[model samples]
Target: MAEVLFYHLDRQPLDRVLPGLLEKCLERGWRSVVQLGSEERLEAIDAHLWTWREEGFLPHGTSKDGHAAMQPVWLTAGDDNPNEATVRFVADGAGLPDPAGYQRVVMLFDGNDNDAVDRARAAWKEVKAAGHDTTYWQQSDQGRWERKG
Candidate 1:
């Protein structure tokens, strides 16, 4: 079964939080595909990952980048894992595809957005009912992630 993780975004925006998560994925030797809700989001994330930090960069590419299979992180607005990624990050209200091929699936939802939170709740139930191992993570008062369920 795939591991499904839900991140309730309260303390930080996705741009700040996502790079760190992707970095962790890289450290574990896992390639990743970040699926966003729109083509604009995919483009924005592609640029953000390029210059989010001055000293570091997350090597990634979108569909326009040509070499999809060579990217360590593939960014897309669609359900395509051209990089053969083992992990998938569903952000910005993007709907998840089947998680069978992925080792881990992360759904990051805005905690302040009622619709996003509601979607996350539904997704959590659906994933669990589908027999996947699911966990809920929320930011603590100190802004650190703590698994709540």
Candidate 2:
């Protein structure tokens, strides 16, 4: 079964939190796919990953970049997993893909947005019913993640 993690982003925005998570996946030698809710966000994140840090960047590409199999991190607004990623991160209220082939699925939602929180709640139930091991992590006042449930 895949492990599903819900990250409640209240203290920081997605752009600030995502790069670190992607770095963790790289350290574990796991390829990842970041699914966004719109093409605009996909473009924005694709650009951000390249310059998120001053010293180095996460190796990533979008459909326009081609060579999907060569990217360590694939960014897309669709459900396609061209990189055959073991980890999938869904942000901006993107639709969840099937968790069957993935080792882990991370859902990042804005805690301050009621609509986003509601969607995450619904997603939690869905993933639980689908039999995935699920966990919830909320950001503390210090911006550290605390496992809530």
lDDT against the true structure, per candidate, is 0.93, 0.94
Worst 10 residues of 1 by lDDT: 61-70
Clash tally for model 1: 0
> Candidate 1's residue-wise lDDT over 11-121, tens digit each?
999998999999999999899999999999888899999899999889998878879889989998899999999999999989977888999999999999999999999
RMSD of 2: 0.8
lDDT for model 2: 0.94
TM-score of each: 0.98, 0.97
> Who wins the lDDT comparison?
2
Query: How many pairs of residues in model 2 come into backbone collision?
Result: 0
